[model samples]
Target: MVVWNNSDTMEPTFILRAFPGLEYVHSWLFIPFCLAYLLALSGNVTILSVIGTESSLHQPMYYFLSMLALTDLGMSLSTLPTMLAVLCLDAREIRASACYVQLFFIHTFTFLESSVLLAMAFDRFVAICHPLHYTTILTNSVTGKIGLACLLRSLGVVLPTPLLLRHYRYCHVNVLSHAFCLHQDVLKLSCSDARINSVYGLCIIIATVGMDSAFILLSYVLILKAVLGIASREERLKALNTCVSHICVVLIFFVPVIGVSMVHRFGKHLSPVVHILMADIYLLLPPVLNPIVYSVRTKQIRLGIVHKFGLRRRL
Candidate 1:
């Protein structure tokens, strides 16, 4: 097992373990890791730039896309330094303070993403269910308020985690299973009683992500009812098609999160490698895939991307 570089002091340090039994191949792992990281960064930046430049894309739905892209960028960058350092340079040690900061950004971005998805679902709901009132309901000022509310909600929920964690004492070897710090992973290393931390964490997840997901489902349910009321089959298909990209984004974000939760809850018998890999997927996959999904599924985004890349004439 990897060991911590320092003793368990007031300000402890933790070692970030990459794939177990693959230390010799750690350097080689950088190739795929860097590629994925770069892909995530470039993809999200392209999404943001396209949305910014395309005047026609300045509506509520695209505004929400920009928010998601920004969240992805924040998430990807949060894990980049430690991941690269651990994989390429064998610099596995991280101070508790820095770890807490990373944990803050990761969780904050995660909750923010969930909230943004909920907002997008509302966008779809308005567009399909109340077509005549969509513009009236989701004006530029209203959308900005919605985005600000999401940010404040995520911040309010996650700001206390690090402070709460500071009260716990670490007696276990402070080696994290993954390259980056997570709230649960950090909580596991606490020697002090952490029932409160665990409970608080669970409660916030249930309140924020859990509730957001439920509301998103409710919105879609209402949207389906609205769509089915449409007399024309073609019109129904068109309305449903508008939601495909958001649905795909939701799945990619939540499925891996569910996988990670299940692994933590029931997969104690599994290898540490399983936990680490699952965490990485939960962190990296959505950012890398969200832009690709939107670019392919939403014609406006696809056209913007093609024009930005100067591929409009060729393709």
Candidate 2:
């Protein structure tokens, strides 16, 4: 009923489907995706530039924001080429090596985002709960160390994924469900037993994102407690106000992730486009929305942007 090819002899190309039932309008789909890419790239780049140039913003919180911007930039660049090829030129065949590379970056930045968000929550916790010690606690060296640790943690965990995936021989339908490669999507197309991949993938999510989310929640709970302890309502609101952007970033990042997971697990009977769009949203939404949320919610960041772009007089 089935066959598996040897790893060495397998053809290493996959067809990336854009919209399963809406292929006729593939030409038109290019415009929105192109605009999304442009927005994600420009927004994240502007945030990074503003943070880098604004001396007053060079603190732990902004450092974490810079990390978030860098992560979004990485995600945008990771998918941009293949997405453009698929949507614009109708070029969908991605080689296995290339696919694995893309998968690595996509997943790496995903975990990096989780780690950075956790770090940001901790930054907030310290800034709110112990304002006197915030500077000494999260000094420049300490922030740099934390950023390095996040990068190392993400890389150390994700490095084995593509290697393990490469060992599996893919001999069945090589059509990918989305325009980009994902571990789960690619693994499903393999003819070999992928219990190891599946289990490892699950474990990594639980260990990384799961643990990070729990810690973030604990940080917020402590933040809430700190805010409530303030004597005045105005003080409480001011303390909580600083967390709005991080909370928004966290929601946008996690909501679509949960949506994608739910769709993959329970939406088997639904249209393929639903799955594709969910996955696309999960990948694209955070990067496109993070800078917008920050720019809108954080006054310091807004001022930094204005000063960096010489827009104060214009406005």
Candidate 3:
């Protein structure tokens, strides 16, 4: 089992165990990861640059896309570097402090990304449900505030998590279930009682992701109702088409976020390798897929990307 480097106190509050057969699986996983990492970065940067340079894209929808790209970049950075190191540099077992910081930012960025998605959903809701009033509803100042809210909301939820994690004392059993220092995984290593940690984690999930999902559903509910009343079949179909992309994004993100949380809490006996791999998938999957989804599903972003990349003759 991999051990934390913080052995100065002779008692570890954080436990991380080395798993068998991980090196093999770990080695093979990075191949796709490298490709995914490059693609995600390229796609996000292309979006940002294209939107920034093009005056026509200075609108609410593209503004949200720019923020999405930025958040995706952050999401990728949070896990990929350390992940790549683990595979390539033979570096395993991070320091407890390092682990806590990683936990904080990883949670923060993911939370922020979720908020960005929620904002995008609202954008579509307004644009489709009230086309004439879309600009007035989703103005530049409002978009900027929404972007800032993503950061604030993430930090607000994340700040308490590490503080809660720290109160526990490590007496015995410091082996973490997975590679990176995940909250629940790290909680499992605590020699002291972790009831509060578990409760707080659940509360945060309910408060943040659960809260966001609820609002998203409500937004779409209103959107659907409004669309249904519309006389133009073409307009209704167009609105629904826009929603399809957002729906795919929501499923891709929330499923794994909630899934990893459940597996960590309930399925303790699952292979450590599986635990690590799945957790990584949760972290990386959204980033890897975000750009692809946007490029293919979002016409504006796809045009922006193709034009900026000089892939074909400029129209």
Clash count for each candidate, listed in order shown: 0, 0, 10
lDDT of 1 at 282: 93
RMSD of each: 1.6, 2.2, 2.7
Off by over 4 Å in 3: 1-19, 261-270, 313-315
lDDT of 2 by residue, 117-209 (tens): 999999999999999999999999999999999999999889998999888888776888888999999999887899998999999999999
> How far out, in Å, is residue 142 in model 3?
1.1
Using Cα atoms with residue i matched to residue i, what is each candidate's TM-score against the true structure?
0.96, 0.96, 0.89
Tens-digit lDDT track of model 3 for 144-169: 99999888989998888788776666
Deviation from native of the Cα of residue 139 in model 3, angstroms: 1.4
The regions of model 1 sitting more than 4 angstroms off are: 1-10
Task: Summing lDDT over every window of 10 consecutive residues in candidate 3, give the lowest-scoring window.
Answer: 11-20
Q: Model 2, which residues run further than 4 Å from truth?
A: 1-7, 313-315
Q: What is the Cα root-mean-square deviation between model 1 and the actual structure?
A: 1.6
Compared with the true structure, all predictions reach lDDT values of: 0.93, 0.91, 0.78
User: Which is better, 1 or 3, measured by lDDT?
Assistant: 1
Q: What would you estimate as the lDDT of candidate 3?
A: 0.78
